[model samples]
Target: MENRIDFVNWLDPDMSIQILTCLDDLSDLLRVTCVSRCWRQYVIANGLCRQLCLRMFPQLSKVVHVVEQRYGTKDPAEVGSSNFMEWQNLEREHRAYAFLARGCTTFPIRDLISEPICASSTDNYPEESIDNTLEPRDVVAQRASYWSSKGNSNPAEPEMLLYKLMGDLCVITEVSIQPFEAYFQWGLPIYSAKAVRFRMGHPKSPVDVPLGESYKDYENKFIWTYTSQEFPMAQENRLQTFKLPEPVLCIGGFLLIELLGRVQRQDMDGLFYIWFAPSSLFNCSFLVFMVNCCELFQDQCASTLIEYFVILAIIFSHNVYVTDQL
Candidate 1:
């Protein structure tokens, strides 16, 4: 017996809902909404869908697409450069969304991003200091002054402490009181030296008299600061906090761009690229795919229909709990 069927009527509410849920699980939570009005409403009405959208869709989208663009293998059958460019565009969007989804911290996140390598314990010294014999003779004999042409001929002459090899000039400033570690980077070593001048602290009007020498004898010197190419400290400036007022989307994109620059500079490793690339690519690919698909079927799918589907896709398949899935 042949089965009599009406295609439109066959799509019962329950069946439609089940199909959407399945789409949410399989393809994309956001994509499923594009299927139909009922699917859109069902995903929207469910709180689970919202959470999934937050956790999975935006963030994961950033990861997948970013990586696929720059490092994706070329395929003859694929669109190649065009898709790669498209991926880059989406990568920017994904990054912005991801950054917003997870609040980006400005406190030198890059430092934590890289793996720590063990080196000499320059900060903490052991109670039992190594004998002079353990240290290199050159370092041990180091004096407090820059070497001058006047030379070691006069024992009265002070020797330079930190020498920039290949140059005769040496610096000796009165900044730091005790021996302190200088944060050095890019071949420039920060010296913890005090300035030679002081600021006046006079309560005028002939009220406060002079206390021995005027306050002109000393100035507050800034030292003991580490210099990183990532975060540079301006002279005379102390630590301060700044707020980011950008939308979560814009900030996320900025962070991604920052990450890319660092990666290109070789400051970060391949693992970071691996971690971020996937999510970025995914977002780009999915968004672009949806946009293209909608445009292609515009004759049948109205713009509102496309939007509804996109929103539904975000809802049903969205997985908020899916963290670091890539």
Candidate 2:
């Protein structure tokens, strides 16, 4: 052991951090902690594990800080926690990041919408219901099927479609929308929005907003925790996908699709209506073989940082969830 070189001791702190961060695998980082007490202290003290986790999943940036739910009996101010408190907190974060990064494998892509909650408006009740969007094909039972917002003279009057996920937590990656092509109407115009945005979160209250024909009372319904940047839509008769910048773990099960800047107008009515046909809100899921994320649910460590994505796959396997690739 005399001839062995100590990188943490001999190298500059910044250089040492850079070298350790270069390690791409979780096993490589875990080995660094096992090398010696100095290496372990340096690794945890500098927060190499949390840094790597953020590097891998930029979505974790939303989490401002980590606080253990269980606290000491005495206040930290009364008993100095500069050494022990900080060290234990660092270890907790280290363990969390390490567990989240472990055993990542390919997961099947699927739809996360449990059910359609409501639409801002409807052109013709029962005929143009939000439920029609669930059907993949534009034509259902030999008839054109689509959800159409009320013809608004003001194109600026944006429309919204709300949906619920299968679980309380969902890791959302992509959302796909298809503008409806009106074949029955003259010249066959595609009713599409200039841009679209997606929002995900949980409802503020236990009581759900009233759901019925063309419900518009969305105010104070939910607390949106995550909102994606506006994605410009196309006036075509095909599916358009807007993948999120990164995989976002949505704490709440609710999602809202806001259609902005309508571009189509009914020739007869002279009003714009954002028509949607089988808009697939695809949930890009993840699977973890090594880490039992279910256990993290029990520990309650996942509420702030990440949640189990395997829930999406479970819904798919049950054969209730239908996701159309097109």
The model with the greatest lDDT is: 2
lDDT of 1: 0.23
lDDT per residue as tens, model 2, 1-326: 57978878999999999899999777889999999998988989998888886776554565555433322233333566588777777876777667656533134337767788888888887778888888766677778989888888898889888887765545677777888899899999999999999888766655565555344576466767788899999999888888888766565578888999899989997988899876544332422222223332442433353332221111221122211111
Cα displacement (Å) at residue 34, model 1 = 2.0
At residue 293, candidate 1 shows an lDDT of 11
Error of 2 at 122 (Å): 2.1
Weakest 10 consecutive residues of candidate 2 by summed lDDT: 310-319
Q: What is the lDDT of residue 232 in candidate 2?
A: 96
| RMSD, every candidate, angstroms | 23.4, 9.1
Which residue ranges in model 1 land beyond 4 Å of their true spot?
1-19, 24-27, 54-326
Query: What TM-score number comes out for model 1?
Result: 0.19
Q: Which regions in candidate 2 have their CA more than 4 angstroms from the true location?
A: 1-4, 12-15, 21-28, 34-41, 55-89, 101-108, 205-216, 282-326
lDDT (CA) per prediction:
0.23, 0.70
lDDT of 1 by residue, 1-326 (tens): 99876332478756755654454332275555566775444555543243443443333232322121112223323655876655444434443333323322121121111111111111112211211111223133342111111112222221111101111101111111111112222432222112111111111111222222211221121111111122221222122121122112110110111111111111222111101110111111000011111111232523432221111111112221111211
